[model samples]
Target: MRKILFHLSLILLFSSCISNKRITYLQNLSDSTAIGLEEFIPFAKVDYKYILQPFDIVQIDFASSDPTLVEGFSFQRPMQQGMVGGGGGQGSDPLYMNGYSIDESGMVEIPRIGKVEIGGLTEEAAKNLVQEKINAYFKDDVYVRLRIAGIRYTTLGEFNRVGVQVIYKNRATIFDALANSGETSLLGKKNKMFLIRQYGEGTKIHQINLNDRALLGSPFYFIQPNDILYIEPMKIRQFGSADNLTASLALFGGVFASVLLIVNLVTGGI
Candidate 1:
């Protein structure tokens, strides 16, 4: 009986041991190369510049030598209580409150400039277009700045925390998305990360293998606004029938107890 129990425990332990191949990320690359990792072939020759879309919130700001001239174009709202400003304070700023949502028609109505069609344009292209209009009004002394108000994304499945995240950076990567969501849990399958992206009229899904360095060259490397990232669970997690360590241990314990009871009953004694 002792021997049976010991062997069963050993089997459970060995089954639970996850292979390094399944957990380790960027496994295809070698550290012995003389070139720095940064110098490696840049990811995605496909342009990562996100195009404007309907319902996308955009923040547009103008700076000029004369504050009064551009003041009419800016609007400010009271900062909400408990909402800290980006620079680390409760101080209010006009741009934060004055985000312009792109209408279904892909146009933003400027105060003096009227309606500007920016729907299909990249942020840089939109900026230049807006700058040209601003230039027509103010000549040389003014500068225009434009950006997506926030890079909003959602993470689901096999993550420690899953929710919609709004990142402030203009450019973010898949790694950035994972890091923001408290990173993936132990069961999160690095090789099966899925990126669901909006393309034109419909949506498309792309598989990303985080364990392979070659993923660095994929077009999906940089995350786009409104992207949905779903991290799959390792097969072991499914086989173990538990999403977490405590649950797995409890499940194992219950199975062991059941086997012990069966053994004792068969022998008519402990």
Candidate 2:
């Protein structure tokens, strides 16, 4: 009976404890504490570029050699000098109000230009297409500038803060998104998180292992608009607050004492 209890305690301790390797991000190729620059020789970094998709909001700024055309083509209302929020946090409401959204047919309606197809095109391609359209109409120096409003993403499950988060940047990495949303909880699964991305074709889920170094080179390293990052809770979460050694030991002691007290009462009654 004593041996059985001893083995049960060992099993509980081992199962509930999380190792450092599982939580650490971007592990080296050789899995060494001290890695040299030589390890990066074979690592090929992949550059991730975001392609515009349907329902994506785009910020359009128009400038022209003729100043009147600028006011005519550009529809965005100027905000008060101190109205803009700080800390890389731009509210989605303002962007949605001022920006143009791509329709299901991959078209965005520009002021006086009507609807123009831009979905599935890169930022540069979309900008050039808009430029050509404006030039054809005005036949003058009409410059068109285009940018994605911001990177808006949602986080679910085992995160410190779950829900929609907006980062105001042309490009943002996975780490940047995580940081904006307060990162994951202690019980969050670092190795097996999922990134649900929306493409022009359809939505696809990609498994992301944050602990692996190869993630830095993966195309999914960069966060795209409307991305959903989900971190599953580790099995240790089922044990509640007894995830650490001290807590587990205290839990074991409490259970053992309760069992002994019950056994003593039963014998005494008998």
Candidate 3:
């Protein structure tokens, strides 16, 4: 019986302890080459440009010397909150309604410019296409500005906060996304996190290993709009609450004491 308890304690000690390597991010960057890990590739970082996709919302601003010329092209103004007469005013408009959504056919239907195809094009390319059409309408006097509304993403599984989040920015990195979403919990498998992203053809699943330094050179380092980040829990998490060494030792101690009490009771009866 004592021998069984000794083996059990050994098993629990080895299995329930969470290691620093499993929780740390961007490990072994300087010694990556020496450790037989993949070297950082330069071209992958240079060639990355986010392409516009269908269902994406973009804010378009048309500016001109004559305000009336661009009035029809303006989106509805979001409601301002204040005391109106004796009661409060209207609340702010929904974010989606503030910008024009790209239709299934990859076209944005403007008031006079009609439907212009901008999907599959980069942000610069899309801006140029829209600028050309605006130039034709106002004869080059009208200035057209275009940008994605926000970097919207969703976090699921093992995150401190799980749900949709939107950051009003042109571009956001994976770290930014994680930080904005309250970051992952200790039990989350940083090495096993995966990303679900949308593409022109369809959606694709990309694996992201935060524990690896090679991730810096990967395109997945930067998160795209409507991306879903899912983190699976570590397998060791199921053994017990091993978030820290103190917790693991306390849990092992409790189990050890409980077994000892049971053994004493059985021996006393015998």
RMSD of each: 4.6, 4.1, 5.9
lDDT of each: 0.77, 0.78, 0.78
Q: Sorted by lDDT, highest first, which candidate order results?
A: 2, 3, 1
Q: Candidate 3 — what's its lDDT?
A: 0.78
lDDT accuracy of residue 194 in candidate 2: 97
1-270, model 3: which lDDT tens digit per residue?
A: 777877877887787667889889888645454234465456345464667988888888889898889999987776745412111113332456568889988899988999999999888899999999988888648888888878878899888778777777777778888888878988899988999998756888988888887776678878888899999987766654334646766876897889788997897798
Please give the distance, in angstroms, between residue 149's alpha carbon in candidate 3 and its true position after superposition.
Answer: 1.0
lDDT tens digits by residue: candidate 1, 125-154? 999999999888876578889998878788
Worst 10 residues of 1 by lDDT: 84-93
For candidate 2, what is the TM-score? 0.80
What would the per-residue lDDT of candidate 2 be over residues 45-140, giving only the tens digit for each residue? 555556898888899988876798778776646663433222233442667678899998889998888899999998999999999999888977
Candidate 2: stretches off by over 4 Å: 29-49, 76-92, 241-256, 264-270
